[model samples]
Every structure is written in C-alpha cells, then in structure tokens.
Target: VAIMGRNKKTLDEAKSKLGNGAVAHQGDVTKFDDLDALYAKVDDKLGKIDVLVVNAGGLTAAPFDQVDEAIFDSMSDLNFKGAFFTIQKALPFLNDGASIILIASIAQSLGFPGMSVYGATKAAVRSLSRTLSAELADRGIRVNTISPGPVETPIYGRIGVPESQIDGMKDQFREKPLLKRFGEASEIGTVAVFLASSDSSFIVGEEIIVDGGIVNI
Candidate 1:
C-alpha cells in the first residue's frame, strides 16, 4: 500500500501504522507529474499496483451566491479533475484485474443548500466511476464508488460554516438517520476493503451508499 498526500506528518504516521505493507509518498493528487513520479517509485519497488483507492478530496460549503470562482475551481479541480487523472495516469501501472475504488459522497444525489459545488464535484466522480468501468472492462479492471454521508472526519470543521453553527448542523441529522448517528471513517474504510478485494469481483460501476439511510429517507 502507498499513501499519497502533501502532509509529511500524516504520511509518516500512516507509514508507521501500516508498517512494511505501506510506503508514504508526498504528492498532490491534482498534479499528474507528481503522481506519475510516485507511481514510478512504487512500481520500481512493488512491481505492480493491485488496488487503488482514489480517496483524496476536499469540501467547501457556502451559499451559491457567496461562492467565488476561485473557491469553485479549487474544489472542482481537486475533487473531479484530480481524481479523474489519478485513475487515468495509474492505468499503465495497475495490474490487469486491479480494483479501483472511488470515495464519493451522498451529497452527489441530494440538494444540500450550501453544498452545491461540492456535490457537483462528487456527482462527477460518481459518473466517472461508471464511464471508467466501461472503458476499462476489456482489461478486467473493476471501478466502483462508495458514497458516505456525514462522515465524522476533520473535513466537517472545514465546511465554511461558523464553528458555533456546526453543532446545530450535526445535531439535525441525529434523528433523521436510521442509524441515528454520524458515520466513522473506519466504516467507510471497511467498505473500501471489500471493494478492493475479490469479494466484490462481480460489482462494477456501482455506487454503494453507506449513509445510515440519510438519502434513503
């Protein structure tokens, strides 16, 4: 396993926790050249990539009128453009029957007031999963997406809402979900593991929504 990110500290921690099975490379997903270099290094060491989880993303929430071009472009470029190219560039290095899992979001299908741009980017990711799955079918590469809602990640603090307003936003979902709680990152990770393994070999171009029934209701 290889971890890609701009944060050296986080990468170091991942390297330590994942041990010999993991290698840490500092690179930005949006930059194809950087990703290419990382892939080169990994290929030189590991020979071939059997699984890829395009898990890098960001979220920016603001009123439609308040969203600026810079903000919209930043989110779209990182979430959509970055993710699309990451898979495209990794094609040569991926094994013949590799599994590719994209981390998407339930917001892609729902209209959350301030999440328009963020949701649009995630929607693009979901679409990319289907199209890429078809494109890579001849090679037996499996492409699928996992959509999680209200995951308890540090990202929620960066939702462009006032710190004081975040608790209220989180509280609103408590009773609305069938699970009656937010999801943990580990929950998403487990779904990703299944998708990456042969257990999900027959699944392709599918979006498994693990949102605690948020969108189902």
Candidate 2:
C-alpha cells in the first residue's frame, strides 16, 4: 500500500497505522513535480501499483456570490486538476487491469448554497471516471468513483464550521441521510476496497454512492 500527502508527520502516522509495508510519500497532488516524486517512490518501493485512489481534496464553504477567484481555482486545482494529472501521470506506473478509485462527493448531484464550486469539481471527477474508463479499457483497467455523502472526517472544521459548532452542525446534517447519521470513514474505505478488489471486477465507469440513502431517499 502506498499513500501520498503534503505533510510528512501525517504521512508517517498514517503509514504506521496502515502497517510497515505501506509507503508514505510527502507531496501535493496539485503539483506535477510532487506527483512525479510520489510515483517514482512508488515504483522504487512497490514496483507496479494495482490500486490508485485519488483522495486528496477538500471543501471550503462559501456562497456562490461570495466565492472569489482564489476559491474557485483552489477548488479546481486540487480537486479537478489534481485528480486528472494524478491519473495521467500514473499511467506508466499502473499495471494493466489496475483499478483507479476517485473519491467524489454526493454534493455533485445536489443543490447546496455554499457548495456550488465544490460540487462542480466533484461532478467533473465523476465525469472523468466515465471517459477514462473507456480510454483505459483496452488495457483491462477499470476506472470508478465513490461519491460519499457526509462522512465523519475533518471536512466540517476545514469548511469554516467552528470547532464548538461542529457537533451541532453534525446534528443538523444527521437528518439529511436516511440512516439518521453521518457515515463512518471505514464505511467509505470498505467500498473503495471492494472497487479495488476483484469483487467489483465488472464495475467500470460507475459512481457508487455510499451515502446512507441521502441522494436516493
């Protein structure tokens, strides 16, 4: 297993938890050079990659009217451009038949006041999966996306929700999903594992919504 992030400390911590065999590379997906370094490390340590998960992204809540150019570019650079180039550069390192899993969001299909830009980027990722699936089919590779709803993570804090108000915000969001709660990170991981494994061999260019029925219900 190999993981890449911008923080060495966080990367090392994750590497510890993921086991000693997991390779942790410190780099930003938004930077082409960083991505190159990441893949180079992967090639040196792991040989060919069988699964590539493009999960480096974030959200900054701002109403459409208040979204500035910086906000727009930041979202696009990391979400859309980052995911695109990450996969493009991984082509050489990916073994034939490898699975590429993109982490998108359910907001792509919804109308949220401060989520316009974020949703748009996620929608782009979902679209990329379909086109790339066809483009990579000749090599037996499968491209898919997992659009998670409200999962338990640090997204709320980063999106401008105050620390004190996070629990309250979660309470309000609980009503959005039919499950009456936010999803666990492990729940999303399980789906990614399935998509990465042979269990989902036939699934391609698909967007699996692990949203606790939020989008459907």
Q: Which candidate is the best by TM-score?
A: 1
- In model 1, what are the clashing residue pairs, if there are any? none
For model 1, what is the C-alpha lDDT against the true structure? 0.91
What's model 1's lDDT at 114? 91
Q: Write the per-residue lDDT of candidate 1 for residues 1-217, one digit (tens) a residue.
A: 7889988998999899999868789999888889999899889888799999999999888899999999999999899999999998899999999999999888899998898899999999999999999999999999999999888989879877998778988998787899999999999999999999999999999999998999888
Mind sharing the TM-score for model 1?
Answer: 0.97
lDDT, each prediction? 0.91, 0.92
**Which window of 10 residues has the lowest lDDT sum in candidate 2?**
160-169
State each candidate's clash count: 0, 0
State residue 71's C-alpha deviation in candidate 2, in Å.
Answer: 0.6
TM-score of every prediction relative to native:
0.97, 0.96
Q: On residues 1-217, what C-alpha lDDT tens digit does candidate 2 reach at each position?
A: 9999988888889999999788888889999999999899999988999999999998988878999999999999999999999999999999999999999998898877788999999999999999999999999999999999888886787896567766876786798778898899999999999999999999999999998888898
RMSD in angstroms, all models?
0.9, 1.3
